[model samples]
Target: MSRVRIFGIGSSSGDDQAGWLTIDALLAAGLQCDDAMVIEKLDRPGANLIPLLDNTAWVILVDAMQGSGPAGRIQRFDQKDWPRYTKGLSTHGFGVIDALSLARELGRLPSRIDLYRIEIGSANPGEQAGDDIQAAAQQLARCIAADLIATLLQA
Candidate 1:
């Protein structure tokens, strides 16, 4: 059972690749995952994400969004904040919130779930992520690393 799990969710698109970038930055920053930690990169996971959390105690999910925010802007939210932010908007065909709701209903959600979304202006497939989006992903990686460190310290 992994105590801490970080999942980067998105496809290989321009802004959609923000999640992948964040995880790549973290790994590049020498993030050492002991047995208790697991880092995964998910592409268009949709409802399949539920099974991935079966053994995870804490979850940090990062993804890109085409919502009402400036491109490159990063938004952080806990599970409780999901209803407020995720309406019917997402760069992917199936939004993250949809999976969250399913997980909640199926009782597969972890106790501590943190969601990070990077606002994207565009996410055309095959295009590389913009500088601003990459910068935001790096920033988000720092924030997530800090949070994970704090959690580890508490335990």
Candidate 2:
């Protein structure tokens, strides 16, 4: 099995900009089910992210966020520091951060996790996230993938 993994959750909100950009970035980077993944919602990102933790050493969650940043700004949240940065309302009932916090509170959280969020212009664009932000999200995706791959290769 591929060791590197990514779970991308974009909202059906924010004009869908973050969601589109995240999916585009993953596609542009050529990440796949075996090496990486781009998901639209965290609560239902399927079984892809959950099971991997059993055999993998790391997991990266990438998505879009509103408030406290400029467009195209990239943000990183470490597992330990996620709480301070992740308290807010998400269109997707309980966002990845919320779900994670729940898992952690219940003592079922992953041993290692990383979160990378790209500040988007907005989430709509119904069809796609436009050009510039899509590229930016893709950039974030590559960085996320590289980080995972690096960790695995090192081990």
TM-score of each: 0.95, 0.72
Give the per-residue lDDT of model 1 (tens digit) for 56-117: 89998998888877889998887778986575268766678889889999999999888988
Each model's lDDT:
0.87, 0.59
Instruction: Please tell me which predicted candidate would have the highest TM-score against the true structure.
Output: 1
Summing lDDT over every window of 10 consecutive residues in candidate 1, give the lowest-scoring window: 84-93
| Model 1 Cα shift for residue 43 (angstroms) | 0.3
